[model samples]
Target chain A: MIPVITAFDRSPDGGKGLARDTRVRWALEEAGQSCDVRPVSFASLRQPAHLALNPFGQIPTYEEDDLVLFETGAIVLHIAERHNGLLPVDAAARARAIAWMFAALNTVEPPILERQTAVLLESDKPWTAERLRSIDQRIDVRLGQLSARLGDDEWLDGGFSAGDLMMVSVLLRLGSSGLLDKHPGLAAYLARGEARPAYRRAFEAQRTFNTRPGPSE
Target chain B: MIPVITAFDRSPDGGKGLARDTRVRWALEEAGQSCDVRPVSFASLRQPAHLALNPFGQIPTYEEDDLVLFETGAIVLHIAERHNGLLPVDAAARARAIAWMFAALNTVEPPILERQTAVLLESDKPWTAERLRSIDQRIDVRLGQLSARLGDDEWLDGGFSAGDLMMVSVLLRLGSSGLLDKHPGLAAYLARGEARPAYRRAFEAQRTFNTRPGPSE
Candidate 1:
């Protein structure tokens, strides 16, 4: 049976597929799976029903027949583990791939989110510029390390796996910030991830969801 | 052969077991695995040898013969997957447990880390107090949601798993800030986690390592 996942009624990213749901979508698409989407408004997200599925009241909560889960990393890992495409078959390689998944979400994404917080929440603060600078510096350090690691490699490990999918998703947040351009290799890397047919479909699906006209429009 | 994991030469936590290594160590103890700890100084962490092991040049890197891994979440998950104690035998329960692990690291810990950044990096800023207040409120939102979810529960789910282990570890970061106290249920929950024999062993091991006299001392 197909699983269902929650997404934002209106993504803050507008038409861009930067929402967490897009990660799960990309994973599903990569795995040749079809699923259902349930969109929840900001208010409905905090409601008891949605909270039952996701205690955090966040989007992209996955619900199968008997099992329900939240956290995009976990959901993606679940899909990848159950299916065949997103993880390597080798025991050690798979562990390394999973490690990169955690690195993408836990290590790499933190400072990027901090930069977003600085830009979105603290722009009016006097320290905004300095905060952005510091956040960017931190991001650059990771990018430099990542670039060194990725040097001429197609994927983080062997071939494209969930690790690349997650790293590319996290790196995409830096697109508008113009940080990707600073490292041409990473820019090319992100481009490769986006070029995947699965990613393209996922991006388009989220775009349609975001751009659909409503009474407010 | 015993595995080797890196730790801070002189932990900033001063043996209180707040560093990320403690999480891995706790997982190892829970699994009844004997491993070697290699302490890496801050300067040495960025050196070529360490960078080769961990591209991000951070501590708590796991080296098991042919495999090298980083990220505390990944390391802990690795130990749990290899050992029987930290994960349930049922697949669905395991999935749920892993979701909590991701939720702890990605969702819950981000704001806590933000608070840490504010305290350590931006404490002298003119807006420090107000910024800290904002950060704390964000943390409180997650804690409130977590408290509601964890009401009257001994562990996060059916039993003690890696999920609870990670959640308790992440919540420990908020100890000095007194944020966990606001949610008495969650605080009690954390106390129960600390009461585990595995946690005690891991904490004592890290404490001994951290408190060991330096050459200069």
Candidate 2:
């Protein structure tokens, strides 16, 4: 089976590839693996069948043969581990790559998500400005540490791996915040990941999905 | 060569096993691996020596022979991948277990961390209560989903794997929030994980490091 998964019925990003599914799609495309998409509304996602695939009722659960997987990090890692391109062959390098993946999701992404929640949900709150500033500062600290470590390097570790893929995905969330431009090297690094053909393909694919006419439309 | 890493000279948790180092210690104990602990003061963590091992200046980096890995998920996964007890034998089952690991950190822990930050940094902000409520709701949603999926099951996915180890570590952060109590099942689940002998050993080890009198004390 060509592993099928869900995508936003319509992405909040206005068809941008910022959706989590886009990352998995990009990984599959990069690996030359064919896959399928199942567009789901927020309502449909809560239904029993979708929840069965993803307990979190989130997007991009991968299904292949007897294996079913959720959590984009795990799915992407699965692809990276099974295929050759996304992970390094050397054991130490591979471990570091996985470490970066965890760091991206676990460490870097948290503040970004907080910033997003602040923007999307709490914009009208009295302390929105203060909360936004604090969250952004946290992002800046993490980015500063990451930028210092990455200094003048093309990717996180050695060659591009799932680590870079995940880091770029997390960093892309900073698009509107404009905080990324504060560090020219990190900005360039994000651009480099976006420049990948696989990323472009994934972007367009999600864009197409988002733009597709809904039943009412 | 055995791996040794630093702990807080004086833990913010005051030897309650809430420090990040405890997770690493627990994984080590579960793997039945003997390791050394080198306690470091807050002043020392940012110094060049520690930064060389962990660029992010965070806890639980692993050092074994030529390899040094950061990110607790990476370190725990490394131990799980190498050792027998932490992971499973079958391929698909192993992948699912890994998915739970990602879900715990990426999905579950982020909101809890936000709650911590709100209390630590943003508690005085006018919107603190609202911000906290939103973060708590997000956490509760994840827990509700996880608890429903878990549905009286013992461990996530299957017999205790590294995934459970990680999930428990992440859930432990909610100790102060009293959010876990919202779901009796998850509360019980955490209690069971804490009951493990290895977890107790790991807790005591880190407690020893945490409680040991520092020069400042």
Candidate 1 chain B superposition, TM-score: 0.98
Candidate 1 positional error at A135, Å: 1.2
TM-score of 1: 0.98
Off by over 4 Å in 1: none
Looking at candidate 1 chain B, the ten consecutive residues that score lowest on lDDT are: B208-217
| Model 1 complex DockQ against the native | 0.88
Across A191-214, the per-residue lDDT of candidate 2 in tens digits comes to 999999999988888888888775
- Please give the C-alpha DockQ score of model 2: 0.89
Candidate of highest DockQ: 2
DockQ scores for all predicted structures:
0.88, 0.89
For model 1, residues A1-217, the per-residue Cα lDDT tens digits are 7899989988998969989999999999999998898889898989999999999999899999999999999999999999999999999999999999999999899999999988989899987887788889999999999999999999999999999999999999997888877788999999999999999999999999888898421
Which residue pairs clash in candidate 2?
Answer: none
Chain A: TM-score in each model: 0.97, 0.97
